[model samples]
Target: MAIHPPAQEALTPPAPPAPDRLTGRARLVLLVLCAAQFMVSLDFSVLNVALPVLGDDLGLSRSGLQWAITAFALPSGGFLLLFGRIADLYGRRRMFLAGLAVFGAASLLATLAWNPAAFLTGRALQGLGAAVIVPTGMSLLTTTFPEGPLRDRALGISGTLLSLGFTVGMVAGGTLTDTLGWRSTMGLLTVAAVAVLATAPALLTESRTPDRPRLDIPGAATVTGGLLALIYALSTAAEHGFGRGDVQIALVLGVALLIAFAVVESRARTPLVSLPMLRRRTVAFGNLGGLLTFSMMTTVVFVLTLYLQEVLDLSAFGTGLVFGVQGLASVVAGVYAPKVIGRIGARRTLSFSLLGQGLFIAALLGLGADSGVWLATAAVSLASVCHLGAIIAYGLTVTSGVPNEEQGLATGLVTTTQQVGLTVGIPLLGVIATADSSLYDGVRTVVAVAAALLIVAAGVVATGLRTVSSPAGAETSPAAAKPSLAAAESSPAAAKSSPSGD
Candidate 1:
């Protein structure tokens, strides 16, 4: 009689909630995700002001101190593609939480570091965590918000938070370094990471998929090693002369490895990067434009920071306060940029913004060591606005052109390019700037060159813009495109997912 009852059990059906629908809980989840994004972006620039203090406390030389920054940047930039794919194959929310955990742990380790090597290791782990967080955050946001005004608003807000995070970090870093010492900066990051981790389980929802691709181990190692080598070589050249044998050797090896990576991607059944995506006009031009734009921005910041400190003789606090004007300008510009793009269209808006950025950067050349404080600040402020507008517009274009499935890969590629540009910009431009007698004179030269680069980047976008029209005669530029797509194929996810759908 009991054996008959054992055969009667029925399987329960799974939950029926629509994945595309944005529920109240979905909005809350998105907010938490965006907060995490803000925190990660903030940490990138936050450490800039605290570097000197950290160096002194840890007995790090100038070269060693620079490694502290590079450690975070190198992993984040190089491993972006690898991590973005991991999120897609695994789960965006799961990967994001894992990243936050790693980030928190690394920050804790950094806070306790008694030597340069330990601190660098911690920074590298933090970078690895960031590599997971950034693209995954965008992917989750895209999944939660369907394409339209809501998605645009969310993306715009994310953009604003990115700039705001950097501002807050710089301000907080300086204040903390001055008051509590540099170690507190890492502690602060840890606190933020913990908050993110705690909120994630409740606010974040996981996406279910029937298939998971195998890890692209070779692709991961090749890209990571290649980028690290390239950046390391460039950074070393910045410190020591470019003529050094070690720098040359690293550069050669990096180029060779990257070439091999390209070959591997073409043959692999499950390639890490989607080579075909690189052939898309939108992806190629937008990414190249982003690279140039970010490089110019990073170089400008580097030169201005030095000019303020060395030439203007401003203290760290004073520099932060002064640079706050740029941040404010960027925030304002970033907030309004979407509206502006909506009205004028992406190509025109991008052209105008890039031209403005170039003019503003070139304008900096007119300022001398004896120039008035207001004049210098005003120049930087104007450049900041232009830079902010260009970045927002460029970001929109880059994310909008690709199909939803490729958004994550696209985003990763763009982000990686931007990071590479930034990593190389300082050294490349700094060398040119310092080739002259006076530091002020060198800065002027660098600004002029950066302005030229912006102009060229603008030209690239202008050329690409003519080709991005929809069948309806309306532009499908980043601003106009709707964000509707499934979890795996969503636009936001495409921003940093694997180039291959796998």
Candidate 2:
């Protein structure tokens, strides 16, 4: 029989079945989901660009202006995990819609804010809404696009939009603030939220964990409180040296609560973050790499934003345009990330990206009063390519081997670290940038420290992390054991496959 068959047929490989194309309504659902992600990402950068003008209108001191960011950071960064778990228990669609409504309402309040109290409160509320929206929306995405090539492309596009949104927001914030005044920036988000609310509910399917686990209140409280205190302490230390009594108190309280949180998580029947998940070196180191990547890159951006606007007297719009260059590079890096990972592996890619990012940022030391704007632009944008490449890789690394039952928790953990790094960046780097005799000197100091940290993070991840291939499996919560509503089917973009930057 072997001799009778043609040699080619004997060695023939089976052809794979064709994957479903994202057609018609499927495309519409993805569009809606991606749009929401854009809005969330947009909000991150838009407000920062407006801070100077907004602070002036509110008569805030340099220190008081920080509350505008800190208020938003506290709720958005702290409540992400709590909200992520809630979305899994309750219906994801229901939570996503509710989140949009709250975010819209909050944006409206900030739009017409008459005082600092009103403005800060609105910012905090908006943050709360974002905390709910991000995880639920991503969950919807994971449920819609089944794992494989289809999901990879969908996620690729989503990841690209996320990076692009921040850059677009910076540009938009500048123009809007310059023309319509500072309030217009907030007003724009209100409009975007209203549009999203009108169309999203009709296309997406609902999903929830089958066994609606009891909320881990103790774990939630200590962790959230701890992060809030930690962020506050850092920001306070930035403005008022670390020696300040308030900073010291906050620092101490934050550490104590976090320690308590670890103990609670170890014992909880259904912990918010299972201790064992972190035993996976890839997960633990991936998050650390993610944290350092975001913290350093964001700090560099903050410093440049100030350098362009304050040191060199560039207009807000001008500053935005300059950063826009970096955004383009980030997009390129994000888009091609999967191929890069496939070729070299996630661990090595992460290590190389971190090292590259450090070198690019350190080169920024040349930026000063006398340097050309183009030179600074090139360095920042190149560094962004490296930064985003690493961030996407880290996301993949963290969620690689996570089971479906704990996908929400795993995703939440990644988002939480991202938020923390983002919150910590401006404050921690701001401290270094402000510590020296001059702003220029401070900028120099910030870059040097950030560069060194990146190298250290590279060493940590390269030597310690490992690749984890996802296996076929599904876990339904107790409530979800019954027939589930058929979903469009999605796996996280960065989970099964790597992602690209830009």
Candidate 3:
């Protein structure tokens, strides 16, 4: 027989379409992905305004029924890494769609729920879906948009959408609860999820590791369990005393389980959290600084919220308008983060952002009950700008230099710290504020403490992120870790091919 090339060897993938060629479809994909993020972010607060109604309808007390929030937060905050890694190993598109379905189904369950038990079940399921969607959506976004301006813009938009979601959720919750019913809040989510599910399969492309490794069941279990314990402890600590027995037990056990997870990750052939990845300065200290930054920013809002409503006697609408300044500032900062990063570099942006945040907090120390709203408004807006900058910069720093196969893990870590930050921030600082004789006095104390914390966080960013070397493959090129959507369309097999050409 005549010599012939193997049939399999002759097979070839279609040429990858370049990033610039698919601008229309690219924008569609970005829109769909951001919508999902908005949905996930909205779920975090949409139910807050409905809580009293829910409590009354379910015949429960404030304390007795509060688990609805906890149930959602616990899983959403906990399972981000596990789900993100799963998306990378299996398929990002698959996980994203499944999450949408789960979230929608859970919203339906809550809408029809007749009792607390049913509602709680739905909330927890929603959290699970939120956890899955966020990291996966982020991974998809980064991978879809090539590095540099394209990638930066995508992240900036994502940050903006996420901030808008939080504010919109709280506002929508009250409006819907007042006009419709508590179930209307969930009904809104169900409708949104259904819409996302219907369109995503077409707008997004599927991509996974070429040689997907076997799932790390132990790492998944330990991390998920540990995060659950930690989230619950922090959540309860916010309401109950931190010294409460359950908090102490959960804290200790959570730490132990996490330690065990670290050990497992260190030894695993294919770890869920690659040890080498964490060794990167941007990944390690960046996340730590992110944690501190998020906590301080959130705590500031929490204290000021109490001061405005309880002491200053601002109405709910007035409070909303006041917070509107912060929201607007956040939007502006997030929109500009990409350009800022382009000009100043991610490390500098992060460091300066943290430093700015500390100064803003210090300025808040000068405000008193009688201080004009403009002073409070200006301080809050400026502080919010800094907070948004850090959030975006830290995200870029961590995701830089990672590979496509690991972007899921990278984004997962970024989001996990966010959830952890939100969970711990208010409670930790609320204790200090409440300990004082008066609320505004405690507000001043909170400002001092938050300023100190932000200063420390700035140091961390300077030392851990700014000072780190640009080790080869350590976020050297965005395309390495983030493949373009066109590339994913042409060849799923090329997902892990080369870092040089995105």
Candidate 4:
């Protein structure tokens, strides 16, 4: 009161100027980006619950119906790298909007389809759109948020939303297929895609990067073909025997093409994925963990849904209600996982989560046709929580290690690995499930194999992670420390002279 400057004025330096209000426009853009991400992620699981209904309606044979799922997954997984490079060369906003358009159009086509073939065609197109959307979304987010806690929070939300989408899609698909028909499920997808498309223009801004590269046509062809061949072979081997001549040929050709693509990338002026990024232990091992986690999770969903409906004689709605418990658990785990990581460290958290997931998968073997619904629900819920924890931890580890510029590529690789794992896991594990006449016995075998795979993945991550300390414990790079302290001490003139915004 006695001529003292206001306490606020003395403590704070004129607000350091409110760093540009995260403009209303920017918020809208982030919303649209996240919406597209949700749509793509939802599509991955939406069809799982609707598969039987769709097959029956369209008179699809078992193998033929399987292709409907495969058509979407195989293309999306294989084309991720190609699309990531495309987003880098073209504009992320441009690719993202185009993807939404394609996805919406495809969903419309799917809604109108009277035959399995037509529906499969639409699914393939949707996969193409997905291949574009995921990497582009990551690229846009990387450019928008800058690195640090802000980006981590944004990505954490993104990851949580993705998990939520998976849960919602399964439940919604079952409800729609039961009440409104499978076509209505497709129609729902169309609406979501259209909404994202309509909102993109006003909300999203184009990324500013110098020197966009030419499209890598050869790389795209080789990688896409390789992935297609590999997945096709896997699917066929699941249907036929692995020793089939066609399967052998496909495996050989696919491996050779992938090798050729790698060689081409090494020589290309603008490679689809930087070879050095793969050398980083975090990126490589984190992706491996994602692959294993999603692979088993997808298979578990597939098998359990079948068990609930076919063996236990539950209605679609009842099954949804049962599965909803797992969804709730996943949401809680995903929301709280960052805090858990902060306390336990990412490496330990990831290992423990994976181990938990493995035990849950093994526990599922106890559920038989006579098992109580609550028993099944509790096991699945625990597994889902573990799944969420593993995903968030691994995601944090991978994203943190890369430079801001490479986030798109890194995210694309992680998404691709999960997609490929989903595609492969279902058919591979489904084979184990179907090999026996006794349904319960087959499910037990399937769950056992999945549990083993997760355990192996946990071991791989544990071994790989021995070199690095906790996320905050060790600076991955020496340069990371200098910038923050220097920025605090710098004059305005010196701050502006720095290459990167500290």
Q: Pick the candidate with the highest TM-score.
A: 3
Residue runs of model 3 more than 4 Å from their true location after superposition: 1-22, 466-502
The residue pairs in collision within model 3 are 400-475, 401-474, 401-475, 404-481
**What is the per-residue lDDT of model 1 for residues 403-466, given as tens digits with 9 covering 90 to 100?**
5455566667766876687678877888876677888989988999999988887887788776
Please give the CA lDDT of all the candidate structures: 0.76, 0.78, 0.84, 0.76
Candidate 3 local lDDT, 1-502, one digit each (tens): 9986655433444454434333888889999999999998899889988999989998767775668889999999999999999999999999999999999999999999988889899999999999999999999998888656677778888888887788788788989999999999999999999999999998899987767899999999999999999999989888877889999999999999999999999999989998878887788877977898888887887888788888788888887788777888888988787788777777888888899989988988877786556677789889888888888778888887666878899999999999999889888888888778998899999899999988877876687654432322123433334555644655645554434335
138-165 per-residue lDDT for model 2 (tens digits): 7677667764445544555676777788
Q: In model 2, which runs have C-alpha deviations exceeding 4 angstroms?
A: 1-21, 56-64, 309-315, 468-502
Task: Give per-model TM-scores.
Answer: 0.86, 0.85, 0.89, 0.85
Candidate number with the higher lDDT (1 or 3)? 3
lDDT of 1: 0.76
TM-score of 1: 0.86
Pick by TM-score: 2 or 3, better one:
3
Off by over 4 Å in 1: 1-27, 208-210, 468-502
Top-down TM-score ranking: 3, 1, 2, 4
Better of 1 and 3 by TM-score: 3
Q: Over the full model, what C-alpha lDDT does candidate 4 score relative to the true structure?
A: 0.76
lDDT order of candidates, best first? Answer: 3, 2, 4, 1
